[model samples]
Structures are given as C-alpha cells and as structure tokens.
Target: MSKRILITGAAGFLGSHLCDKFIAEGYEVLGMDNLITGDLKNIEHLFGNENFVFHHHDVTNFVHVPGQLDYILHFASPASPIDYLKIPIQTLKVGSLGTHNLLGLAKEKNARILIASTSEVYGDPLVHPQTEEYYGNVNTIGPRGVYDEAKRFQESITMAYHRFHGLETRIVRIFNTYGPRMRLNDGRVIPAFIGQALRGEDLTVFGDGSQTRSFCYVDDQVDGIYRLLLSDYSDPVNIGNPHEITIKDFAEEIIKLTATDQKVIYKPLPKDDPMQRQPNITRAKEILGWEPKVDRAEGMKITYEYFKSLTPEELNKKDHKDFSKHIRK
Candidate 1:
C-alpha cells in the first residue's frame, strides 16, 4: 500500500499543485477545502485520479479522515490581503482553531504534520533579507494583522505540539510564489499587474513602488516543502528565492512582457505592508540543500501566459468567488 497523506486547502493555487505533486509521487492523496477562497476548478482535473480524493469541508471545524494517514499538510487559510481583510474571523479561526484540530488529528494518527506559514509574519521588517532567526516586527492591530497574527500563532502552536506532545511537525515560511492557477484578481502583485496589463489598463504601483519583493516559482516552493517534510528538521524553514526586485522595476518588466501600451499608476500603500521581503535562504541551502532554480524572467513569462489564457469573462469578472455561504455568523 502507498503512503497516505491529507492536504488542506487543496483546491487553492499552491494546494492544487501540491495535490498534483503528491499524486505524481505515488501517494494516496486526500484534499480538503471549504471553497471560501479556494476554487474547485484548480483541482477538478484530479477528480478522476484513483489516488486522489477531495473533501469539500472546512478545516476550521472538525476534520475527520479515516484510514491510516502518514502525513498532513495544514494549508487552509485566506492568504491574500483582500481575502483575509474581508473574512478576518474565518482567517483567524482557520489558523488557530483549524490548526489546533489538525494538530490533534496528527497526534491521534501519529502522523507528521507540516504547517504552511508565510512571509507576512515578518511584517515590514527592519532587518534586510529576513532570516529564520530574525524576530518579526508586526502591528498586532493593523488591517493585515488578521492574517499575520494567525500565522504567527499557528507557528507557535505547532511548536508547542512538537515539544510537548512530541508530535512530528514541519513549518515552511513561504515567500512570494507565483505560477499557474493563480486567480487573475486575487490581489497578489504578480497576478494584479498581469491582469491590468492584459486588460490594457495602467499597472497600479503603491507608495512610489520602492517596496521590494522576491518571487519564487511555485515548483521551487513545492520542492522545498516536499524536502522539508521528508527532512528531520522540525523547526521553521524559509522556502523562497532570495533574489529581490522592486515593485517599479517589476511593473516595467510586466509591461514589456505583456506588450501593453499602458503606463504605471501610483497609489497609497496599504497599512502595515512590508517594504522589503527577501528571504535569507542560506538555511534552506545548507540544510535541505535547496535553492530556487527558476529565474524571474522565465517564471514571469510562464505566469503571464497562464493569465493570457483566461477567458474574457474570467478576466473581466471582479470577484470570481462568492463568499456569502462560507461567511459564518
């Protein structure tokens, strides 16, 4: 019998790709998502695979998976600013309550669990090129606090389980990752710029666009996560590209790639937005022997092609997901 694993948020961009990766690796994969921010279309292609099973359930509530489970990847959460700001309570619950439930399940099944953390935990860092040991500077009451605090709390609780219960746990502090299956209007930089260019609209750059970010292709991110899961390191590992670029330069690159005759527009930066986000991946290279292999030009080209393939209806649709039913009272 093949090893069995459960992946939450499996219908989301990264989760869906993970589903494909695990299935290709010959694992019996179980995918769960609430569709709050996750679209089933991302994972619909895997519905026919005999090794794949999907559960349309919310992990913030009870998560029950029968049979022997070898591993669990806890990835259920609203990752973007737009999604988390709209559903703050749900976002908090998924990271806190949802993580607690999954931790309990992992302990029960004796399964090793990996939590998906983000660069948001670093907030607007005072440190350059964030390292694993750098304590973050975050505004607990800021608008972005809902997501950042949730992830910070998730990491805390995950460590508690690892130390107290002796449960096997892995944490991946993912950085800016982009690739196919990304929602065109998801409020992420890569997709947002691409969407504007594709529509022949001016690219929107916030706060003079000096803010910097590093992009890691989804394949590289997944590969690092896979290696981390299998490695013996139990502490948090940063899985992202260290190469950084400013927003203004990135916008110019996007404009050139799309060949759109549009200019760049400036807007006020949002509250608590990170000014610089470059990961220090020395730990990843030394421990996991991993570093992002995809260059920005190649990765951006692939991402642009993915966005260009979207239908006119999808491109124009402001909000593709309906959160009415998922919003809890």
Candidate 2:
C-alpha cells in the first residue's frame, strides 16, 4: 500500500504543485481547501489520477482525516496582504485554530506534519539578509499585522506542540514565490507586474521603488519543501531564493520581457513595509542540500507566459492597484 499525505490548501498555487509532486511520486494524496483564495481550476487536471482526491473543506473548521496518513502539509492560511486584510478574522482563525486542529490530528495519527510559515514572521526585519535566527521587528496592530501576527502565533504554537507533545513537526518560512497557476490578481509583485504588462497598463511602483525583495520560483520552492519533509529538521527553515532585486528594477525587467510600453507610476508606500527582504538559506544549503535553481528573470519569463495565456478581459478584472500600494518603495 502506498503512503498517504494530506495537503491543506491543495488548490492553492504551491499546494497544487505539491499535489502534483506527490501524485507523480506514487503517493495517495488527499487535497483539502475551501476555494476562498484557492480555485478549483488549479487542481482540475489531477481529478483523473487514481491516487488524487480533492476535498472542498475549510481547515479553520474541524478536519477529519480519512485514512492512515504518513504526512500532513499545513498550508491553509490567507497568504497575501490583500487576502488576509480582507479576511482578517478568518486569517487569524486559520492560523491559530486551524493549525492547532491539524497538530492535534498529527498527534492522534502519529503523522509527521509540516506547517507552511512565511518570511513575514521576520516582520520588517532589522537584519539585511534575514536568517532563521533573527527575531523580526513586526508591528502587531498594523494592517499587515493580521497576517504577520497570525503567522507568528502559528509558529509559537507549532513550537509548543513540538516541545510538549513530541509531535514530528516541520516549519518552513517561505519567501516570495511565483509560478504558473498563481492568481493574477492575488496581489503579489510578480503577478501584479505580469498582469499590468499584459493589460498594457502602467507598471505601478510603490514609494520610491527602491525597496528590494527576493523571489523563488515555484519549482525551486517545491524542491526545497520536498527535501525538508524528508529530512530530520524540527526548527523553522527558510526556503527561498537569495537573489535580491529592487521593485523598480523588477518592474522594468518584466516590461522589457513583455515588450509592454507601460511606464512606471509611483505611489505612497504601505505602512510597516519592509525595505529589504532577502532570505539567508545557509541552513537550507547545509541541511537540506537545496538552493533555488531558477533565477528571477527566467522565473518571470515563465510566469509572464502563463499570464499571457489568460484573456485580456480576465486579466483586466484582476488589476491589483491596492495590493502593490503598500509595498511600494
């Protein structure tokens, strides 16, 4: 009998990709999501596979595990600022109650669990290249605080479970990642730029556009996640690309690739925005034997092509001006 793994938010960008990975590897994969931020179209292709099963359920509520599970990948939180801000209470509930529920399930079944964490825990970090050791400088009451604090609380509870119950738990602090199947209007930088370029609109830059961020392609992120799941690490590990680029430069690169005549438009930066966010993946390299394989330019090109496949009307509807408003330089 093949091993079974439960993936929360299986309809999400990363979660969908994980579903594909696990199914391709011959595991019985159960994908669960509420379809709030996740879409059914993302996982539609997997319906034909015998090993894949989809469940329309919210992780914030009690989740019933169907069979004996070998692993559980908890990635059901509201990820984007626009998403979490719009659904702040749900975000908190998912992070706090949802995580606790899943941890309980892990303990009940003696399954190893991996919680999907974010670099936001290192809120507006004081360090240049943030490592797992650097405690963040986050604002608890700010708008983004709903997501940040929720994730911070999630990590705290995860640690408690690890120490008290000895539940085999893994936490990954993921940085900015983009790829195919990502919602064009989800408000992340890559999709935002691609959407604007495809629509022949201005590529808006926030603040002075000098704020820098590093991006990891979806494939590389999945690779790192896979390695970490198979490894023996219990602490939170950072999984992201180390390459850094300014928002302005990143916009320009997208424009150049898409050949869009769009110009740059500057806007006020959002409150408590991190000026720089680059991951220190030394632990990933040393422990997981992983490093980001795809560069930003290459990743952007692939992502742009995916955006280009959408109809102009579909692309226009997702115009995410406010999402980028906060992260502007």
Candidate 3:
C-alpha cells in the first residue's frame, strides 16, 4: 500500500510545487483548493498523472477524503495582500476557520499535519533579522492584520491541537518566496515589478522603497517543508533564505536584469507594512541540514523568464496596478 497525503491549497504557487514533490516521491497526492487565489494552470500538468488527484473544495468547509492517509499539509489561505485585503473576511476565516477544519480532519484521519505560516507574523519588527522568538508588533485592526493575525491564530490553534489532542503537527514560517507559476497580477512585489517591466510600464515603488525582504526559491522552500513534515520537532521553524535586500535596491536590480529603460515611480506605503523581513534559519540548518542554494541573481532571472512567458493580456492587465483599490482597505 502506497502512502497517501492530502494537501490543501494545492493549486497555489507553493502548494502545486509540493504536489509535484510528493507525487515524485511515490505518495498518492490528494490536492484541494478553492481557486479564490489559485489558478488551475499551475497544476494542469499533473492532470494525467495517475498518482495525483484534485479536490476543488474550500478548506473553510468540512473536508472529507475517503480511505487511509499518512499526511495533511494545510496551506489553504489567501496569502497575498491584494487578495486578502479585497476579501478581508475570507482571509481571516480561511486562516482561522479554514485551519480549524483541517485540524479536525487531521485528527479524524490520524495523519500528521503541517501548516504553512509566514514571516508576516513578525510585522514591522522592533528587532532586526527576525528570529522565531520575536513577538510581533501588529495592529490588530489594521488592514494587513487580516492575513497576519489569521496566521498567528493558525499557529496558536495548531499548537493547541498538538498539546491538547496530541495530534501530530508541524509549523513552518515561510519568508519571501518567488518563482514560476506565480500569478502575474497577484500584486506581490516580484510579480508586480516583473509584470510592469514586461508591459513597459514604470515600476511602482511603494514608499521610499526602504523595506527589505529575503527571497527563497520555490524548490528550497518545498525541500525544507518536506523535511519539517517528517521531522519530530513540533515547534515553529523559520524556513527561508536569510539574505535580505531593500525594495529600492531590489527595484534597481530588477531594472538591470531586464535591461529595461523604464524608470521607477513612487507610491504611498500601506499601513503596518513591515520595514524589514529576513528569516533566522538557525533551527532549519541544524535540524533539516538545509539552506537555500539559489541566490537572488539566479532566482530572479528564472522568475523573470517565467513572467516573460505569460500572455500579453496577463502581463498588461490593469489589475496589477494596486492603485487605490487595495490601499489599506
């Protein structure tokens, strides 16, 4: 009998990659997604594979999968600021209610569960180079709080399940990750900037562009997550590239890489936006023996090529212009 794993949010950027990884490892992968932020194109290639099956269901509702299961990876939440802000209630619900549903499902199946947490939990840090120990400075009523607090609540309940119910649980704090299959108009920095450049539009820099982010290639993130799922350690572990770069410098780097003459334009920064974000992977290194092998220069080039492969309509879509629609709600 082959191992079986159920992965929610399996159609999203990271989740799709995980589906590929687990299937490659010979696990019968049962993928689920609501398609609110996920696109079918990401996982379309796996449609014909015998080892893969997909469920077009929302994790906020009760999730049911027939038969034995060995693992459940709960990753079904609106991750980007644009999507979450537009659908704030859904974001909060998915992270809180959606996670609760998955936890209950995990208990019923007796499968080990892994929930994807984010670096945003360390919002607008008072401490530099964020560690897992740092309690975040977040405005609960602020706009970004929809996603941040939901994830914080996710971590809380997951720990509760582990302690009270003795359900096996794992949490991974993911940082800035980019690669192919990302929605060009999702409004994340990498895809936004690349979309702008591909469409010959000016790159829009929010604020003075001093905010920093560390980019982890998708492969490295999945590798770390896979290891964390199998590891005995239950506490949250930060899984991301520790190398940090500022928005201003990163914009300049993108311009250089694309060799585009278009200049950057400025926009007002949103509220509660973190000034810095870099993961402290001391635990990941010691435990998983893992660190990102792909550098920004290498990763960005690959990401850029992916953006270039999209249709002109996708590249030039007006939705990428977060103009006033997503301005802190």
Candidate 4:
C-alpha cells in the first residue's frame, strides 16, 4: 500500500506544495485546512487526483484521521504578521490546541510528525545569524508575541511528546520564503512589494529599511522540509537561505526586477519587528544535507512572473481581510 500522510493547513502555500510533492511521489495525500488564512486555490489543482483527498476542518478543534497514517505535517496557523495581528486569538489556539490535537492524532496513528516552526522564535535576535543553540530574545507580551509564543509552546509540547511518548518527531524553523501562488495581498514583503510595483505605487519601507532578512525560494524550502521529515535526527533545525540582504536593498532589487520607476517611502516600523533574521543552517547541512538552491535574482524573477499573471482586480485589492482597523497604536 502507498504510504499515507496528513497535512494540516494543506491549502496554504507551503502546505499545498507539500501535497503536490507527496502526491507526485505516489504517497496518498490527505489535506486539511480551515481556510482561515489559507486559500483553497493553492490546492485546487489536486481535487481530481485519486491519490489526494481534502478535509475542510480547523486544527484548533479535534483532528480525526480515519486510517493508518504514516506521517503528519502540522502547519495550520495564521503565518503572516498581518493575519496573526488580525486574528491573534485564533493564532494562539491553532498553535497550542491545534498542535495538541495533531500530536494526539499522530500518537493514535503511530505517525512520524513534523511541526512547522518559524524564525520568528528568534525575535529580534541579539545574536547575529541565529543558530539552533541560541536562545531567542523574544518579548512574550509584544504584538508579535502571539505568534512567537505559540510556536515556542508548540515546540515545547512536541519535544515533551518525543521524550516521554518516544514518538517520531521533527521540527523545522522556516525562514523567509517566497514564490509563485503567493497571495498578492498577504502582506509579506515579497507580495507587498510586487503588488505595489504592479499597481504603480511606491514601495513602503518601514523604519528606514535597514532591517535584514534572508529569503529562500519556495521550492528550496519545500525540499528542505522534505529532507528534514525523512531524516533520523529529531532536534529543531533551521531551514532557510543564508544570503542576507537589507530591506532597503531588497526594495531596490524589487524595483529593478519589476522595472518600476516608483521610489520607496518610509514609515514607522511595527512594534517588536525583528531587526535581523538569518538562519544558521549548519545543523541542516550536517544532518539533512540540505541548503537553499535558488538565488534571489532567479527566484524573484519567477515570483514576479506569477504575481504579474494575477487579475487586475487581484492586483488592486489590499487584502481579503481589512485588518487596517486592527493596527496596533
């Protein structure tokens, strides 16, 4: 029988890609998502595939899988700053209660599970180029705390399960990733800048744009996740590109990529936003033999093409949810 795997948040960008990867590898893929921040369009192509099935469910509630499961990729949560800021409570529940539900299901099915973690755990790092050993400098009460804390808690519970229950588990701290099928209005720097350029608007730079980030292409990210899931090691690993760039420089690069004449404009930086975020991937290199393969120029070209293909309406819209009212003072 083909190995079966359940992927939570399967309608999401990364999750949908995982569904595609597993399905292509001849594994039976069961996808579940509440569509809170995820879009059905990401996984719409798989609807007719016999090896792929989907459930419309929230992971915050009890998760029930009916058959023998070989693996679970727990990725259900509000990922972006905009989404989490808008629905902070749900974000907390999905990470805490949702992760607990999935871990329970994994235990019941005897499945190897991997939970999606983020570089946000590092939270304005005092240590440059954060490594797995570095304890992060996160503010538990900040606006962004809802996401960082939830992920930290998820990791804690996952580790406990691994130690006490002896369940097969993996944790991946994903860094900034971008690619095709990204929602143009999701409010990440990639889509945000691309959308602004496409609409002939100025690129908005927060806090003089000196903050730094390292980006990995979606394919590279998925590849790293796949490798980590199958590896023997159980500790947390950082999976992301190490090619660091400043936000100001990134904006200039986007302008060049889009061939737009618009200049950048500065605004007050959001509270608790990280000043630097780059993963130290030595653990990943040694353990999983994974490194990001796509360079920014090549990856940015592909991403730009995808966004350029969107409808004019999609190009014009700010976001599906009007979270402007939720902006913290």
Q: Residues 1-329, candidate 1: write the lDDT tens digits.
A: 99999999999999999999999999999999988899999998998999999999989888899889999999999888888888888999999999999999999999999999998889899998999898899999999999999999999999999999999999999999999999878899999999998888899999999999999999999999999999999988999999999999999999999988899999999988899999999989999999999999999889888888999999988877777765677
Cα lDDT of all candidates, in order? 0.93, 0.89, 0.90, 0.92
Candidates by lDDT, descending order: 1, 4, 3, 2
In terms of TM-score, how similar is model 2 to the real structure?
Answer: 0.96
| lDDT for each residue of candidate 4 in 72-142, tens digit (9 for 90 to 100) | 99989888888998889888889999999999999999999999999998999999899998879999999
- What is residue 59's positional error in candidate 4, in angstroms? 0.8
Candidate with best lDDT:
1
TM-score of each: 0.99, 0.96, 0.96, 0.97
In the range 19-50, model 2's lDDT, one tens digit per residue, is 99988888999999987788788999999989
Q: Which stretches of candidate 4 lie over 4 Å from their true place?
A: 322-329
How many steric overlaps are in each model, in order?
A: 0, 3, 0, 0
Per-residue lDDT for 180 in model 3?
Answer: 92
Q: In model 4, where is the ten-residue run with the lowest total lDDT?
A: 320-329
lDDT of 3 by residue, 1-329 (tens): 89999999998999999999999999999999988778788899999999999999988888889999899998888788888878888888889989999899889999999999999998899988888899889888899988999999999999999999999999999998999988777879999888888778899999999889999999999999999999999999999999999999988998899999889899999888889999989999999888999998998999898888887777777664333442334
